[model samples]
Target: MTKAGIIYVVGTPIGNLGDFPPRAQTVLAGVDLVLAEDTRHSRKLLDHFQLHPKLQTLHEHNERELAPRLISRLQAGESMALISDAGMPLVSDPGYILLHAAREAQVPVRVVPGPSAALAALAASGLPTDRFCFEGFLPPKPGARRDRLQALAAEQRTQIYFESPRRILDTLQDLADCFGLARPASLSRELTKIHEDTLRGSVGEILARLRDDPDSCRGEMVLVLGGAPAPRDGPELAPVLLPLLAALPLSQAVAVAVQITGLPRKQVYAEALRIKED
Candidate 1:
């Protein structure tokens, strides 16, 4: 009996077809079948390299239904390759279910790494590459998206995100609001393409650049945000106490602020008195 075949998770170019590695082309050509996120898009990549492997559509909507059948083929000694529309197969795309199934069925699986937009953006952004996080696409809705950003506000490691062209402004504004305008950030768009560019600065600065050069918002984007600044040794007294002072009597505000800040009541009370006297 023939040995069970392998599944190769191949990465294609994020942009610039020249970035397609020779090994990836060979795997796509050699596989018994090639699974693609979009057959039309994948066909262009295949045609570029003169590959004519059997093609099958396997996207988010249909992956669940098709993974089992594909796994069966792998078990039956039919080698296959999975490719996304761009970048690594499963970074922000489909192929996880089928890859999982392949491993569970004891079929050999290999990776053919190529261009990845997230890593590309990060590397070029000059952010700390030692530790980072990949947050693939933020929530489309403003409320939910803001909430998500709020949760990541204190993340110490660099944050990476893939974003859509249309939502660039909204996302930048949201980041400015949650993370504060001074937080450093980098935005790279149309990566590896003709007009590819990276804008690096504080979040507010990048937002202004995007606003002025509306053209920057026209393609796929990867955002790299500097992690929140390390917490100060003591509570931030002023921003914390101002609101309470507005709504409460001086003594009451001081009492509340002291408890909340974990600062000595004497200092808070004195600060409250100064604000009142001013």
Candidate 2:
């Protein structure tokens, strides 16, 4: 029996051809077949690198029907590489069915890491990145999108999202309404392409700029938003007041604690008195 071949889930550059790594180029040149989200788009990339491997469409519509046959080919020792129109495959892109099927069959699989628009935007956004979440594209409908944002209103980690040029304004408006107009965010569009531009500021500020200069809204976009501020109440309130009360007089400490917590002055004063007594 022939040993099964490996499936290379390769990552192509999101935009700039210079970002395409040599390893990806070599893999594409050597693979027996290349499965792409769109052959026409992938062709230009391949042509630029002078690397031509047989191309086949593996988009969302046909991925399910195509998985079994592709698996059979792999099992028979024909190595294949899966790539999206840009960036990594299976990230807001197709190929999940094929990769899952390959795993079940115990076929070897590997990944060629490359550029990611979400990470790029987050890094450029000046937002906290130690903990973050990726929320692909949101629902298109106004009501549904607002509902989704409401659900994530209190998310403490930085959030990343993808939006199209057409819906960016509406989405930003909804985000401002849900996450608050003053929330810090960054909007990156065109990625590494010639027209690449990133707008960083409050959700309201970015929205205002887009409104003023509509040309800024053209091309693919990635939005990185600062997470909701941590709540200071109940148990957490004690730690805040205790330190202030120890360092300053009752009245001054309560005043500082109230400002820090953004809680009711009455509530903070009561807490301060209680801490002083203890």
Candidate 3:
């Protein structure tokens, strides 16, 4: 009787092909089948390594429907490997459904770790890595994105997020508005590539840099924002909110101040308006 073959959740290189581990290559070559987030993208990786396995599409759209069948294959002593287009199989990528299904079926499951953009950026971000949170991607809509940032405003641990090149400036502006212009942050783009770069400073500084240098706005970006400062033993309102009223319109100032202070909008607005009157 044959034993069940293990399901390998593999991580691939985010950029440099040389980052692909020997173990990952062996697994991909030896597997009975390989599940890829994007077959076309993974195809190039496989071809480069010259290790072709049966490729099947298992992305966010089809992973649920295909998971059961894939799980059955694992149960039947057919080893399989799962890979994303880049980075880990399921870090802001797909393969969760099938992995969960495999676990439920009591099939052997394993992970062959490789490169991760989150960790890559965080390590070089010059922020506190001892405690940090990975916020994969913000909502694309402005209102929703700001709302999310507002919710995370007081987070003490450093925050990491994945963002598109085109949206980086807008996101940085939003970060400045929500976290305050002085909030420390880092932006790393095209990690491990020839043009890989990291910019560290206040959110406003990075925003200005990117705006002036359009060349930096052409690749995937990882954003790391410093956590809010510890609360002082006093009314945490005036020092933070009053200045915004001086710098911006009443409503706009209140909106940003509320996000930064986590205070009630009505109260901030009233105070801002009073500041304007005074």
lDDT string, candidate 3, 33-128, tens digits:
999988899999999999889999998898889989888878888988889999988889888888888888998988899999999999989999
Clashing pairs in 3: none
TM-score of each candidate structure, all chains considered together: 0.85, 0.83, 0.88
lDDT top scorer: 2
lDDT, candidate 1, 145-257, per-residue tens? 98898778778789999999899899988887666677788999899999899999988899999899888889889999887665543236677777998999887786666
Point out where model 2 deviates above 4 Å: 1-4, 234-278
Report lDDT per candidate.
Answer: 0.83, 0.86, 0.84
RMSD of each: 6.4, 7.9, 3.7
Best by TM-score: 3
Residues forming the 10-long window of minimal summed lDDT in candidate 1: 258-267
- lDDT per residue (tens digit) for residues 92-190 in model 2: 999999999999999999888988888888888899999999999999999999889878877879999999889999999887766667778899999
Q: How far is candidate 3 from the true structure (C-alpha RMSD, Å)?
A: 3.7
Q: How many angstroms is residue 89 displaced in model 3 relative to the true structure, after the best TM-score fit?
A: 1.0
